[model samples]
Target: MRRRTLIRGAAAVVLVPAGLAAATSAAASPRQKSAQADDLVGVDVSNYQVGFDYARAANEGLDFVVAKAGGCQLSEGPYTSDSYAGHVDGARAAGLRVGHYFLTGDFLSPREAADYFVDNLHDYRSGDVLALDVEVLDDSTRLWNDAEVSTWFNRVRERVGAYVPWFYISTSALRSADWSRTIASGARLWAASWGANDGSYPGPPDLGGSYPDWAAHQYSSMGSVAGTSPIDLDLARPWAFDVSGPTDPPGGLPKTSAEQDGVPGPTMWKRTQNWLRIQSGYTGPIDGVPGPNTYAALQRNMAGNWGYTGPIDGNPGPMTWSAVQRLAAQHGYTGPIDGVMGPNSWRGFSRFINADAWD
Candidate 1:
């Protein structure tokens, strides 16, 4: 059984640098042509901005608001944001998309911190954005290791059924850390980097070879929104926060005796490989070996519709199987979206891969 802990106080430590405030006077505008007209504009807030006018902000054209849920501080141990509840409620009432972020620290175990974060996130809905803020500001020498980061995401995923958590990190920190394991866990990237420190959307950062794509880019920390001054401004993709159902319908063969067996064999893999080659640009041979290239192609194919946002490293984990389950949902698989795959999940998958064209 999971242990629940009480949250202490309304204030928590915010790790944003003091130098960001200098750019507060700059006009909040998109300075780059890369800023697409369809990109959603939003702000992230914490206890520092109290009594924020969410209705006014929404009226002023802000699309979403990501509020600080809570965090485990070095000095205070664990605490909840005093304004978390208010921000969520106000944003929802004003018809703004809502998201919650937890500032992570090295004070507690990753599992413990994740549990505490979920416990304090009372207003989380099925599709609300959930992010783990990873940044160290003081003289603290301890930084979260890659394994710990993956653990935190896995723990959160275990508790929160279908929603995949986002990994929040600055450009410098992201470049320094080896987050290959975290990437394999299907944690979406929410990159924070303020270029020129001006209140303008400077477009997404170069990522410095960290990941392939970013779900959201925090362009400026000095953005002047309607209700809040010098707030963290962001441009997010619609698919990243899209809560609608899957994009494509299942186009698979009818269930056969082999699919009913619910066991994958060389024949099944060959069919899957052929499907991957035809659809997902897989150059791998149809040798019936489910190797890294095969799985990597599968990951790429499932990314847009089935929530497989992890690296295409070819090593399948819960995230990969969960995507399979989502695809399976259309093929008569009525199981939970938990990453655990069983006979039912396999049967549904077999039905899809056993199409005659692939054969």
Candidate 2:
């Protein structure tokens, strides 16, 4: 971090109209001015392990980057990290415009989705764009139908407000839904048509080339830029902005514990507990406790990705414990789920909710 240099208000007033004063101000870094550049070319790096190496890309004529922020209905574990914080800082250092993408989740209510987005967006500021990756599930996953999905997208736009350039990724799932008109009406489109990259994606062969309305085409899935891995699209179109204001909605979450003193809350916790119990066929008080029955429900849920290796019994050995821990951590729960609680776990949960809980 560098020391702050103050520019007097008199000088700021005189330099407002000509633009040279602000351009020449010691306070404004080269990166801040770079936001005014034309034709923004960048990529959407959403994978966690394969991080953003902006300096290398900038050397390769990269002008901007849309980093991945969250995914799948408020599922946690950021694709970006503190290293990425400095990575974007380096991009700014290299005079590149930067933006972000939020992978939309299916099971989340609109409000929950908004909360997830706001939590991750605290780092972004003026002139940045906000994008929504609208392709998560395939033909399975009954979380949301096409129409319901569109509604969720609109809810996101409403919550995010108009300061940022709100955009959408049109994946195969989006194409199948035939909700193009519905979605495009509100958001700038980032169409995904894999011709030379991820084999033949469905629909028109030249969707990207022909779709004049799209802000950018996710031209490839296995993109191999210099310092990055073979990841998804790593490019975007420039000139997508008309204003240079805050890219996120104003007024973030209350910072202190006392700020969330009293309020009626959603039944998501109860709903989640019940859903898990029935899936495991366990009889319990739907208490928010992560008891054996709750763990049973989680095991069944984790059969695919979260790492549940054994039967749906109440015991959480190494495998089951690992899976439970992974799922909990992904959803922004940093506390240990070793069927135990302590001060650290309580602090983690408190931070996770960022709001007061009713006793």
RMSD in angstroms, all models?
13.0, 21.6
For candidate 1, lDDT tens digit of each residue in 1-359?
Answer: 00112345524444555665667666474223233455687888876667888877877778888888877754557777777899899999999988998876757789999899888886789889888887763322456778988788778877876563677888788888777666645566788887786777665665654543476778777777774665778877655674322111245323244588887777778777665654444566766789999998788656634767677689999999898898887677899988898888988888766654454
Which candidate number maximizes TM-score? 1
In model 1, where is the ten-residue run with the lowest total lDDT? 1-10
Tens-place lDDT per residue, model 2, 145-263, is: 54554454555556655534444544554435544333332344566665444312222223221112344555544444544534344333343543322211123223324113322
Please report, as a residue range, the 10-residue window in candidate 2 with the lowest summed lDDT: 1-10
Cα lDDT, all candidates: 0.70, 0.45
Positional deviation of residue 179's Cα in model 2 after best superposition, in angstroms = 2.7
Off by over 4 Å in 2: 1-39, 47-51, 73-87, 137-160, 180-185, 198-212, 243-359
TM-score of 1: 0.64
